[model samples]
Each structure stands twice: as structure tokens, then as C-alpha cells.
Target: MRRTHSLRTRLAFGYGLFFAAVLVLMSAGVYWLVRQALLTEVSQELAAAAELIQQDFAASAGPLPGFFSDPDVLLKSLPPRLTELDTPAFYVQVSDLDDQFSIGSASLRGQQLPRTPEDQTAAMGGSTTTRIFPLGRGRVIQLSAPLLAGGAVVGVLQVAQSLRPVDQTLQVLLEGLAITGLIALVAAVRGGVWIVSRSLGPVNEITSTARQIFQAADLARRVPAASAADEIGALADTINAMLERLESLFTAQRRFVADVSHELRTPLTAMRGHLELLQRGVVRDAEDQAEMTADLLREVNRLTRMANDLLLLAQAEVGLQLRCAPVALDDLVLEVVRELRPLGEGVAMRPQLAEQVAISGDRDRIKQALINLVANAIQHSPVDGTVTVALDQDGESAYLRVRDEGQGIAPEDLSHVFERFYRADRARAQRTGGAGLGLAIVQWVAHAHGGEVLVESALGSGAAFIIRLPLSREQETEDRG
Candidate 1:
């Protein structure tokens, strides 16, 4: 198995790493700038001391021969500040061009200041130069300038300063930066972890809720509402909505299974009873045997019809594609009315086709939908009552309405009339009312043609089912033109 870390841990780590990098860069920059500034200050101080010595030499009478002849006079000619024995900051030295003779500051304590060949060459060339040389344990900055007499270079004067103080200052700064950076890094990491944990709290809750729902097999469980209207809240809302849909589907599935079992069991039981009677030689008379056989055949047909309806619904559920073509809506309605008139018994079917409309759809599916709606109306109508079928159109769509003179559906049941295996009159005889998939099939047909089916009814008045379908492409174009 691969190892994994929590989002909070990863986010906090990244945040801390970024902060540390920035902190390190900032500290390094400050250290470099301060080091440069301190070194520059030291160089300027050495240059000033060397300048004062050169000015003193220039002020003296006959500088080159007189100063070279007497080391004491030469040492005394330097700036008083540079010659201080107690001041350990600056060291001043004077040497000839070949470096054969030299005199140093009292602070040097008989030690000679070291001079490099490059500094000697530069000083002989009459160019002032500066260089750093390692001293006893620290370092020193040396500035060498030409000693001139009568506009001629004769020797070199070197001014140097110890770098111990600069080094000590930088070391202290480094230590402070390290300590401060460490403390800030630790605090930033802790604060980042806390912030990340707070941000992901909702995600943790969602995970826990989903886990519980999975283990318990409960689709009705929902993720808790988020406190803030953020992306997490939107996610929770979406998941809750999906759960609600799944729960509805699961409930419907269970109900469908139970309804199918009951519907199948009734016909199967009737057939079995009739078969048992015949086998026992109970119906000996020819007429009685024929009637029993007809009854058995009726039950078998009912079962077959129920099976076919279930098959159609299954096909629709699995996204069955329709063979679409231009269908004459008025003609199809008339055909369905004529075919189901006998099934109406004493109820009359009156098709008030006010308009001849054409639509694009699967003719067979549309015919089946029409038959189901008309038959359903005929079934629910009172004896000798009228079942009115109307065909009409507006600018963009055609409408097929079927109205029955019977007890209207209750307001609560209207919303669910088109659900599979749902019947308002649950106690109605199965043989007469069927398995209640008719309205569902009608709804599927209407939706498949980019249309919708609607119901208008109230208790005890009557019921009207209207299927609205878009006009055929050619008809719509002609009308628009």
C-alpha cells in the first residue's frame, strides 16, 4: 500500500517551506548588505588616514630625501590619531619603493605591516590601492599610496585597520537572524497547520458522514449543512440533493418489486386453481369446461400484457432509442379511439380534433401512448359517461388532451400519477385497471419527443391529461416563413 498524508499536513508543510525560503533569502540579503556597509566604512576610514599622511608629507619641506633619511621624523609626520599607541583600530606604516626600509605606527608594537607584491607594484606606479591581508587571528584592510617629492614617486605609505570588530558584529547579526528565523518558522508552521485544519473541517465531516452512510446502507442520510456558503457548502448541497434522488429511486424500486410480485401472483394463482379443477375432472360438462378454459385464457392474457408492459418500461429505463419520423397526430388519435371504443364498455369516446397537426416522433410509440391514455380514460369514466379527446395546437406545439367523467385525482396524488406502479385507486381490481404503468409510458413517450405531459384535476370533478409535443420541423419552418 502507498503511504499518504492528510491535506492539512501537506498544505502546512508547503506553507512553512515557502515561508522558510523567503525568510532565508531576506536574512541573507540583510547580512550581505550590512557586511558590505561595514567593510566600506573601514575602507573609507583607512583612505582618510592615508590621505592625511600624504597631505602631511606634502606640507613638509623636501618630503622624499628628508623623510627617508630619518625614520623618527617620518613616523612623527603621520597624523597624530594614526600614531596613537592605545588605539588598536588603525596601523600606519611607511616603506621605500623596494621595501628595504620601513617604520610603523606605535600601535604595531615593533611588528611590521605585511605588504603584497601587487600593492607594492601599484604604489610604485603612483596609483593608490587597497587590499585585505590575513593578520594574527583576524584580517586587516591596507590602503597604499605613493609618497611624492618634487612631483616624483619615492616610497609608499600603507594604512591598515583590523577587521575584528566588523567580524564580531556580523557574527552577532548571524546568530540573531538564526534564532529569530527559527522561532518565526516554528510559529508560522503551527499557525499554518491550525488554519489548514479549520479550512478542511467541512471536508472531514463530509467524509465521516459518507462513511457512515456506506456502512449502514442508508441513502436517506445527508451531509450536515455547512456553516459558511463556500465551495464546501455547495458540495454538501449537491451531495444532499443526489442522496435525495437516490433515496426516491430506491424507494420506487422496492415498491415496483412488490407491486410486480403481487400483480403476477394473482394471475398465476387463478391459472393454477383453474388447472387443478380441470385435472380433478370437476368441470365435466362441455359448456362449463369451455367457460373455465376461457377464464384461464383471460388470466394468461392478463399476465402476458403485464409482462409486456414491464418489458416496455425496462426498455425505456435503459434508454431505448425511437425510430423517429413525421407522424400525423390527428390520424393516429382517430385510429386509437376507434380501436379502444369497445373497451370503453358503456362510456362514449368523443374526439374533438380541432386541428390537424403533424409532429416528428416514433409512430408506434405515439400510437401506444394514445391507446394507453384513451383506455385509461375509458376505464375511469362512469357508465354512459363521455370520454372527450381533443387535438389542438398553438404557435410552436401540438396538444393531445384526454378527459374522463369520473372521480378526479386528489391533489396529493396528482404529482405522482405518472410514476411507475403508482395508482390512485390502490384497491381497484387489477383485471380492470391494469398494473398502473400506462401513465408512465405516456409520460416517457411525451418526453422522448421533446415534450411533456400534464394533468389537471381536483377531487370528485374529473381528470384531464394533456400531452404537448413540438411541431414538426417542416411545419414549424412553414409557419415561421
Candidate 2:
């Protein structure tokens, strides 16, 4: 198995590594600059010393041969600082044109400084050269220049200085940089961890809340809000909204199951009672037996209707597909009104329709929707009241309205009238043998046909349910043109 590190650890480690790389590069650059500056200073001093020695040699001796002829006189011409027995400033050496050692500074203590062939050749060519090489217990910077007599190269003057002081300064700087970098790296890693953890704190809280909800099977719980409105906060808000929707859906599902069970139980109980009465021969008269059989048939038909309505609702919830064809809206309205007029009993049914209003939709589904609306309106109409079915059209859409003279829906119940199995008056709905799914089916049919259903009602007044469906494309085009 591959091991994974936490985001906080990864971020902190990355931050520390980046800082370390920058620190190392900066330290290396600083060390290089300082070392170069010190070496340049020493080289400058060596050049100056060599120049002064040459001037003294030219002043004290008349010619190059005479200068090399006497070692004691040459020694006397050297700088006093170079001759000091206690901690001399520099080591000096002189060599003749033949590459023979001629004289040396007292600081050398009779010790001859080693000369490289390169330095000797440069001196012979009259080109001054400087180099740094290891000596005794430390290092030194040496400058070699040609000695001139009568403007001719006669000998070589070499000057060198110890680099112990510069080394000590650089060593201290390296130690300081190392210690400071280590401390800063540690601080940076810790700070990065803290910042990353704080930023992801809300994510952890949301995860914990979701875990609890899953374990407890409770969708009511929500993720806590974050302190700041950043990306994490937005995520928290989104999760809470999802939880709210899930809770609503779950609540509706439970209610739908209960409503379906009750609706089924009522018919089943009545049918069973009637079947037992007939089976026991309690209805000896043919008329009584026939009535009991009719009651059982009625219950069965009600159950079948409820089952079909439930199936239609299920299809609507998944996504209902319609068979498209040109449908005459006025003719469909008139047919539905004629079929349902007898069911209204004492209530009058009226059809106020416009002419030549057609739509593109499934004919059967449109008729079913019109039938549901007219039936619902007739069921709700008062005794001897009028149930008006009206159809009208505009440039883009057709309107089908079903109005009934009855006690209108309350303000609070109007919004939820199209919800499955919802009834404002449960007792009245039961007395009428309604499953309370008619309005829902009507709403779904309207939506499937690219339309919407709206209701307008007030207390003690009648209610008007209007369905608005888009007109057929060809009809709309012709009208527009």
C-alpha cells in the first residue's frame, strides 16, 4: 500500500524546502562576494608593495646588474615593515633574469619562496601576475612583477600576504548563516502547517457533520457555517443546501408511502367486507348479492385508478415523453365538458372556447389533462353552481381555464394544491372517493406539454385553474408572419 501524507504536512514540507533552497543560494552568493572582496584587497596590497619595492630598488641601485651584485645593499632597500622580526606585514623575494634567487625579506627568515615556471615566464615577459596558493598552515596571495632598470626587465619582484584573517571572517559568517537558516526553516514549516490547518478547518467540520448524518440516518443535521466567506465557506453552504433538499425529499417520500398505504387499505377493507358477506350467503336476495358485487367492483375500479395515477406520477418524476401531433384545443375542451357534465349532477357545465386554436402535443395526454381539470372543477362546484370551461389563445400559447363556484382554497393551501396526495379537506376528499392525485396529474400533463398550471382563488369565492400551453410551431410561425 502507498502511504499518503496529510495536506498540511505536504504543504509545510514544500514551503520549508523552498525556503531552504533560497537560503542556501543566498548564503553561497554572499560567501562568494565576501571572499572575492577580501582576496581583491589582499591582491591590491601585494601589487602596491611590489611597486614600492621596485621604486626603492631603482633609487638605491644605479643599474639592474649592480642591484643584483650586492645582497646586503638590496636587503637595506626593502621596506622596514617587510623586515620586521615580530609579525612581518609581507614576504618578499627577488630573482635575477636568469631565474636565480637574489635576495629575500627578513620575514622569510632565510627561507626561499617557491616560484612557479608560469610566474617566472610572466616576469620575463614583463607581465605582472597574481595567484593564491596554500602555504605553511594557511593560504597566501602572491603578486609577481618584472623589475626594470633602464626600462629593461632585469629581475622579478614577488610579494605575498597571509589569508588567515580573511578565512576566519568567512568561517564566522558561514556558521551564522547555517544557524539562522536552520531556525528560520523550522519556524517557516510550523507557520505553514498552522496556516494550512486553519484554512482546511471548515472542510474537516463538514466531513464530520456528513459522517454523523450518514451514521444516524438523519438528514436534518447541517454543516456548521464557516467564520469567513472564502472557498471553504462556500463549500459548507453548498453542503448545507444539499442536506436541506435531501431532508425535504426524504420527508415527502415517507408521507407518500403512508398516503398510498391508507388509500389502498380503505378499498381493500371495503372489498373484503363485501366479499365475506357474499361468501357467507348473508345476501340471499339476488338484488342484495348484486349490490354487494357492484360495491366490490367499484372498490376494484378505484384501486385501479389509484394505481394508474401513481404510475403516471412515477413517470412524470422520471421524465415523461409525449407523442407530438397537432391537437384542436377547443374540440378537446368541448368533448371533456360533455363527458363529465352528467357527473356534475345539479351543477351546470359551460364551455366558452375560441376557434381554430391548435397545439403540438399528445392527443391522449391532452384529453386526459382536460378530463382531470373538468372533473376536479365539477367535484368542487356547489349545488346548482356553474363550472366554466374556457379556452383562449394568443400569438404564442393557448389558455385552458376551469373555474368552479365553491369555497376557494385557503392562501396557505393554494401553493401546495398540486402536491401528490395533498387534500385541503381530507374528509371531503374521502367522501368523494378521491385519491387527491387529480390536480397533480393535471400539473404534470401541463408541464410535459411545455406549459404551466396556475390557480387564482379567494375565501368564500370560486377558484380558477388555468393551464397555459405553447402553440404549435407552424401555427405560431404563421401568426408571427
Taking the tens digit of each residue's C-alpha lDDT, what string does model 1 give over 225-302? 898999999999999999999999999899999989988888888889989999999879999899999998888888
> Estimated TM-score per prediction?
0.73, 0.69
> Weakest 10 consecutive residues, lDDT, candidate 1?
77-86
Model 2 per-residue lDDT tens digits across residues 15-128:
888989998999999999999999988888778778877776666555535556677766665446454422564788888877664677667678667778888899989898
Clashing pairs in 1: none
Against the true structure, what is every candidate's RMSD?
5.5, 6.3
- CA lDDT, every prediction? 0.87, 0.85
Off by over 4 Å in 2: 14-181
Q: What ranges in model 1 sit over 4 Å off?
A: 28-171, 196-209, 218-224, 231-239, 354-356, 427-433
Best by TM-score: 1
Backbone collisions counted per model = 0, 0
